[model samples]
Target: MNETHSPAFQREQLLAQDAATSNFNYEEFRMQLQNRISHLEKRARQLQKAMWISAGVLILCFPAVLVIEGFRLTEIPWVLPLWSGIGMLSLFLAAVFSGIYSSRYRPLLKRAQYDLQLSMITELQAQVAEINRKLAER
Candidate 1:
């Protein structure tokens, strides 16, 4: 006499099989995370470079204006180096502040990325546990 397996038993067997096969592909996940991190880093570098370039151009133009116009503060009363100096100083300060802000945010970005990875790992572990439990029932 042949014994027939119930539908619930078959479903449980299938679940066990799927559980055994379910595994997290960490390498793929890590590569994706790295790609995102690299993109953010590139963007940060571009911003920093732009800030420095702008500051440098402002500084370079200040001297050129003085040389070409031959203007003196005592003579013209308005065409003074002091105003240019202040403008240059403002640009320099802006660049410095931007650099500091970017530096401060870098670690926060890293931490956010790390948290995302950790959350994914935790989810994978949970899936693995569930699969293991299903398999153990057999």
Candidate 2:
């Protein structure tokens, strides 16, 4: 049980020790995976909030610009429709971009969550194998 033992040796020793216990602490592993999932979920929420906030701010700015150009609207009635059209177009574009951006990252975030779960499962399997090996040794 030297501290400087290689990982394989440590794993072997762990396996040997685990045989005597005949019990695996699965709850700890489950809790760790749950925490990781929670963290990823929070990150997704934050990304969504930021995307919507940015789109809302951009959309709001369009109306402010129209108000600023109100004087020109009176001098040229066509200016009103033109500005309104431009504002609406910009809002539409913002929504499209945000939707695309969110859609893109969402899959990646989900993949990361899936990978984390997979890793935990793999670790559990390794522990189980070690335990079985130790039992066989007896």
Candidate 3:
């Protein structure tokens, strides 16, 4: 009589396998959430840096045009218009970047944070439940 082939033995093995797989899946999900948060944070930082650089260019363009005009550096009729166009373009880019950062990445980061916290709470609850189960068995 091979006890390993008994129905009870097979049932116990299946239950153990299911528990192991459940734990593995939860860990993988938690790691994926953390990775997403990290990527979003990096993207947000990069977008912020780009926005600041565009804003700096926008701020300098006015003084630059003023100085050029004051010094009478060039008689080209298109020079002033060119500088004004550059300024406007920089302003537009800065505004767009700011909007994207606020409306897109910021919200995603917040949501990811909430998801990570929820996963942590779930993992803790599972641990407590398992401990209680073991204590009851004893």
- Which candidate gets the maximum lDDT versus the true structure? 3
Tens digits of per-residue lDDT, candidate 3, 1-90, equal 699999999988887888666567777799999999898789898998998999999999978977887989658788878888989999
Query: Per-residue alpha-carbon lDDT of model 2 for 31-103, expressed as tens digits?
Result: 9989988887777677666667656765776676667576555477676576567667667766765676577
List per-prediction Cα lDDT, in the order shown: 0.70, 0.72, 0.87
Backbone clash count, each prediction separately: 0, 0, 0
Structural similarity to truth (TM-score) of each candidate: 0.39, 0.39, 0.56
**Candidate 1: global Cα-lDDT?**
0.70
Model 2, CA-based lDDT: 0.72
lDDT of 3 at 100: 93
Candidate no. 3 TM-score: 0.56
Worst 10 residues of 3 by lDDT: 105-114
Model 2, C-alpha of 26: deviation from truth (Å): 2.3
Q: How far off is residue 101 in model 3, in Å? A: 1.6
Q: What is the descending lDDT order?
A: 3, 2, 1
Q: After superposition, how far is residue 102 of candidate 3 from its true place, in Å?
A: 1.9
Top candidate on TM-score is: 3
Q: Write the per-residue lDDT of candidate 1 for residues 4-79, one digit (tens) a residue.
A: 3777777777766874345667688899999998987777666666666767766776676666466444466655
Score candidate 2 by TM-score against the native.
0.39
